[model samples]
Target: MNAPHTPASVGATQRRRWWLAGAALLALAIDVASKSAAAAWLPGRPVELLGGLHLRLTRNPGAAFSIGTDFTPVFTIVAVAVIAGIVWYARNVTHRGWAAALGLIAGGAAGNLVDRLFRAPSVGHGHVVDFLYLDWWPTFNLADSFLICGVAVAVLLSMRNVPITAAPSTEGDAVHLADITGGRDGR
Candidate 1:
């Protein structure tokens, strides 16, 4: 029912895992650093940027658009679950695009989870630090950006019918379009 993995395929899968880990770490680091900078620099004054964009710090205890203000702990729990699910799902992600997508989502959720766990108002009730603002949109941070971008990429990949795991090649080591698209029509 399953073909045995060659050394080269194993190596490629390992590389994909490394890419996932690297992306997660990088996203987390950037989010943490940016949040710190925003907290330090945006307390007393808000910076006005181009095209109605501004840097204004706000601590949100709820989810997007400050929804469910009374359910801070619930959000924290959900984030933890989401991160765990992503990690579990990543084990079979041999495709680099899916790996990156999952990594970004996990890292972003972890970044916000850190805030929810230790920022303020006590553990599991802490507020997330949001600094970026726009006149038409609610305030957000880098972690949210990563999450949105990751989801967008994932959606695009799905629309293109890209598989999360590499498809086995029927002819030697060469992957054919039919193998990926499941048929010659690319459907």
Candidate 2:
């Protein structure tokens, strides 16, 4: 059996993963903090910044663009499933960049999953607090930013990686004798 690849020879193969984790953590913290601030200082009040950029307090109990707010529990379950899949994928990724992307995706999904599980009247069905507003886009949070960034990273990495087929090997080039004989030797 072939031996597993070693980290020593790779020098810094594990490097980029930390960056992904850090980005995801910072994003989640910012998301939670901003939502808290909006809840405390801007509740029910809209703040319009220059060029009509706005900040408004809101709760999203749904999927992207508020599609499933009324079914918060279902959304929460799906979020959990997504996080689980990302975590498993990240754990086994060969490329550090790909792992980072997976980690960021997992963490970001988990951050909002946390809200859906704890931030309101019911566990596993709480609303995700959203306050950042844009004139052209649906209101969203830091978790969404991380999620989108991760997706972009993953797409870029996948596009960047092209699999190369191995050349036919001397050890694998031997032909079966049965093909030459056109029948089994016993037959």
Best by lDDT: 1
lDDT of 1 by residue, 110-158 (tens): 8898999989999999999999999999998988888888888778668
Candidate 1 residue runs with Cα over 4 Å from true position: 168-187
| lDDT by residue (tens digit), candidate 2, 1-187 | 5235566423232343454466567766776777678889988789998786798878898875566668888888888898777655443343455555666677678778888888887899888887777899888877777788778876765564411111222334332433223353454
* Local distance difference test, candidate 1: 0.83
Model 2, global lDDT: 0.66
Q: Using Cα atoms with residue i matched to residue i, what is each candidate's TM-score against the true structure?
A: 0.86, 0.74
- Model 2 bad stretches (over 4 Å): 1-3, 9-17, 162-187
